[model samples]
Target: MSGATTPGLPRLGDLAWAPALDHPELLAPTVAEALRAWAGRDDRVRDLVAVTEIDPDHADTATLNDMHGLPPEASANCVVVAGRRGDVEQVAACVVTAATFADVNTRVRKLLDARKASFLPMDRATAESGMEYGGITPVGLPAGWRVLVDSRFAAPDVLALMGSGVRRSKLLMPGELLCAMPGVEVVEGLGVAR
Candidate 1:
């Protein structure tokens, strides 16, 4: 808190981070609930997860990384997908490093046990999950929605920069911690090299 750097956190270039609890305005309602639930369940997560504000225009991974001087490798993108099996609808949020792309048609379809899977339309994603487009995150997704995290994220000491459910901010935390979120599943080959 004293210097420009946050002790123990991975370098985030020019972004200033504080406990997520200290910046309620940066979080959507569901995101706040997700953070609270994680904090209650994991001491490590409670101690490490942080949030920082950013310009909405620079919220996308590429722009945010370039404008903030953050490493692209340290960032992750979440994508939503929807598919149906018989009469049931299946939805999931896929998390992968910015350097890779989610294998939605193959792995995701297999995981959801659907004949086909595709990116959910933006309006439907936003309406169903209550998260803004381009800012949808794995955290706080509806209870029945699966959260698929790429296995690479389980690497030790990896810090992932992800959306905060709103365009105005982002969350930073250990990638492994995100893998531990309720209903989160780490799958090998979930993300394919771009």
Candidate 2:
């Protein structure tokens, strides 16, 4: 029997294959620039590569688990949340493994220092960030949001998934870069148990 592709998942071959097969060297221009700016202070973020992938409408982490063929416990993602403060909209980026949730109502809220932190509207998130819906990455966000990465993703040479600037692509980068981001504070155990 032939292997069939799942609805929200694309085969590895379907990606924009980089012939070099480099793991964390394929970041998008926006992500690359952001990482460079961050590298001035922390060196760990330089090893990351932003990835693009298929539109994953699924909100839960299981979707990523199935798409990447990763165990539910081994996958990690950077979740972006946007809100308003004093008439200015702000964004917050949080990283969590597939097995855990970011706890937007609690952790992300406190991190952003917002009275109320909620997921950004898909349209607004895409339009303001200059990235496609479902493909938002913290690397290219407009200069309004505060970016915070969880230290759990700071492991060297570890693979972390992000948006590809498009619905059909996802970005992958080294986990260490998550710690090296400018203003990136490594909070202890920020991820919520699933």
Best by TM-score: 1
- Error at 110, model 2, angstroms: 1.9
Candidate 1 is scored at a TM of: 0.94
- Candidate 1, residues 94-119, lDDT tens digits: the string is 99999899998899999999988999
Give the true-structure RMSD of model 2: 7.1
lDDT of candidate 2 at residue 51, scale 0 to 100: 42
Error of 2 at 151 (Å): 1.9
lDDT of each: 0.85, 0.57
- The C-alpha local distance difference test score for the whole of candidate 2 amounts to 0.57
The residue-level lDDT of candidate 2 at 11 comes to 25
State the displacement of the C-alpha of residue 91, model 1, in Å, after optimal TM-score superposition: 0.2
Cα error, candidate 1, residue 175 (Å):
0.7
lDDT, candidate 1, equals 0.85
Please list the residue runs of candidate 2 whose C-alpha ends up more than 4 Å from where it truly belongs after superposition: 1-29, 32-64, 83-89
The prediction achieving the highest lDDT against the true structure is: 1
